[model samples]
Target: MGKDAKRSELGQFLKARRAGLTPADVGLPTDGTHRRVPGLRREEVAQLASMSVQYYTRVEQGRLQASAPVLATLADVLHLDDDQRTYLLELAGKQTPRRPRARAQQVNPQTQRLLDALDAPAIVLGRRMDILAWNPLAAALLTDFSQLTEKQRNYARLVFSDSEMKRRYAGWERVAADCVAFLRMEAARRPGDPRLRELVGELSIEDPHFRQWWAAHDVAAQTVGTKKLLHPLVGELTLDWETFASTTDPDQQLVVWTAAPGTASEENLAFLASWVTTHSPGEADDADARADPHAGRGTPPAS
Candidate 1:
């Protein structure tokens, strides 16, 4: 569907959901006085969603793009079911229905545990390609994420801004192009996300390469692939990569890098793991701090 039509449909859906809900249904005090409209009023919905009545009115009129959190809040206030909640997010151009307390960059404990358990390189990525968390192997394979500032931890930013990343990836142009395409896909899903816009804006200004690729209008979903990297420690290595989406939070993905058993790449990975184990713990940490001077700074909210 066209963007305008989709927005209008989203507005209609919101209105319909609101109309089906009564003040009592949402735990609001109700009087028996005659009402001009059915269900909760616009101001009531705004109040429940913690937004301004004028803003809500503009959203219902299809004149504003509602953020994922706002749509999720409205869905809850309107008592929407799971399917309805998904629909609400889809209509709002969001990849997933965000819970009120859910932060896009926060990885669940279970996911973190899984990352820690992995023998190979693994990283958790948000919808905006921000590196939320990474395993020790991931740190060994790529740059140590903890050493980079949160803003610098993003895949797109590293691909464009870090000269070391360009040198690490053997197919730099192809990898950089794919990152741009995947970002384009994310842009379509969350068009109203200010963080995404900011990331794109910063990249466009900083890198002419990013500007050219973004203007190509390419769009791609992250999936299984093979990446050839020239790691400083492990030397040239080809690893198979797979992306798995989180069932609970569709915006979160676990990207794993592994090598085929009995291959030279596998042996190299094993060697790298052993090297990391034998090295002084403080050495890696110190190296990371030196690599990126601005480490430990928090990232901006992805929403």
Candidate 2:
């Protein structure tokens, strides 16, 4: 969509969402007099967000793009949860999806082998966090990749759309925002890819949070980070991850997750390995297919 059309759509959506709220919803005191607007006035929003009324007006009018920090402030003022915040951003074109071209090679066989050999959970993922290839350990720890279609194997999609995956994450809110920021960074790196674009579009339409977070224009590259996972079989584990670029493809990264030695996380990892051994591949595949990533998980009940 053109900038104007995109902006207008987002503006209207925000307006409608805002109208549903009262001053009390955001801790503001209403005068209880005849008010011209359904929601907080532009001046009230600007005061709460610590911005100028003109700037807030520009934002609501879709005449200017808001930075990540500014968007965060606006989200706070609007009492936007993760989904609403993300949808607002997407509507602003602050973030565009990755669009992968069919002609491009997303992953190399050698890299896939490297992932398979890693004793710990590891995966070769594309710029958009697509599971190009994941080792048995990674599949066992998370979801079985064999069951997911090439299109449904995205990390971002799983975070927001899959119930099991969402439950696995300790802080779903932080994970969701990080995914958006990371994807934004990837988009800057691979602007020509059609798969990225399609994924972004699909997600934007599917979740309001994705749309709002996408609009914030945040960029992040956390190649090495810690993720807290609540494994169904093994309890909670904090896994440290490291990402390395594939030798053959700069766009592909090998992500590996490891835990501290002699810790409870190590014990959990061991348990995950055993789960993979007992569960039949046929059973897992059927379950994952039913958990399609593009399918919408309706905006989580406010907060």
Candidate 3:
């Protein structure tokens, strides 16, 4: 649907739902006078949602883009059911049909085992592009996932915010553009995701390049691709990468970077693996941390 039409529909839905509710129904004390309009007032909804009346009015008038947290709060205040909540999100252009919430950052035990068995660098990615888990080789090839804080583990954030990332990739522009496009696709699929919104907001302010690319409204999915990575220890390596959707959790993906057998890239990858083993036992501990099977999921807010 067109953005304006969808927003109009959203406004109408909000107004209709508001008209059907009463102050007492939502635990609010109603004035004992005869009312002019039906249902709870806009001020009441704004109060319930812990937002200003002007903001709520603008939302009901289709003049503002409601964030995911705001929508969730509104859903609660309005006592919306699952279907109605879904409908509200869809109307606000926040979610799509059958799109689940972003996956937690905990990799399952079996998945961790599979990651450890992989010969190439393999990492699991959450829906919002967070590095949920990575093998030791992955830590060597990419950044050490273990060393990064939970918020810093996001691929898009690293692409735009970390200066070292630009030097690490031979085709920096292509890689950054692709990451931005993939993030755009994710935003479209889950507009109410506060963490995703936060990532975008931070990148937009911090990186003008990201702001321009994001405004272009390009959308792409991350799948099989090749990347030219300049490992500090080893020279340049051209690696073919593939992404596999997790069978158990659709929101999680397994990303593996490999080189063709007998190629220089393969030798370089082997060298990197060996280098990781010899240089960083602490990194190996990070890999073992991934196997804990009880790591808590870290949730960063969007707003």
If scored against the real structure, what TM-score would every candidate get? 0.61, 0.59, 0.62
- Candidate 3: stretches off by over 4 Å: 1-103, 281-303
Residue-level lDDT of model 2, residues 1-303, one tens digit each, is 888888788777766756765554343544559988786677877897889989878878888777867876676556554556668777765663332334544666677677767779988777688878888878767887778887788899988888878877888888898998998787666543446666775777687677777777778995798899765455678899999876767777888999999987897687666555666434433344344323222121111
User: How far is 30's C-alpha from truth in model 1 (Å)?
Assistant: 56
lDDT of 3 by residue, 233-265 (tens): 555688999999988888899999989899877
Name the candidate that leads on TM-score.
3
Mark the regions of model 2 whose C-alpha exceeds 4 Å error after superposition.
1-102, 281-303
lDDT of 2 at 244: 87
Cα displacement (angstroms), candidate 1, residue 93, comes to 24
Q: For model 1, what is the error of residue 55's alpha carbon versus the real structure, in angstroms, after optimal superposition?
A: 23
Better of 2 and 3 by TM-score: 3
Model 1 TM-score? 0.61
Give candidate 2's error at residue 13 in angstroms.
Answer: 26
Better of 1 and 2 by TM-score: 1
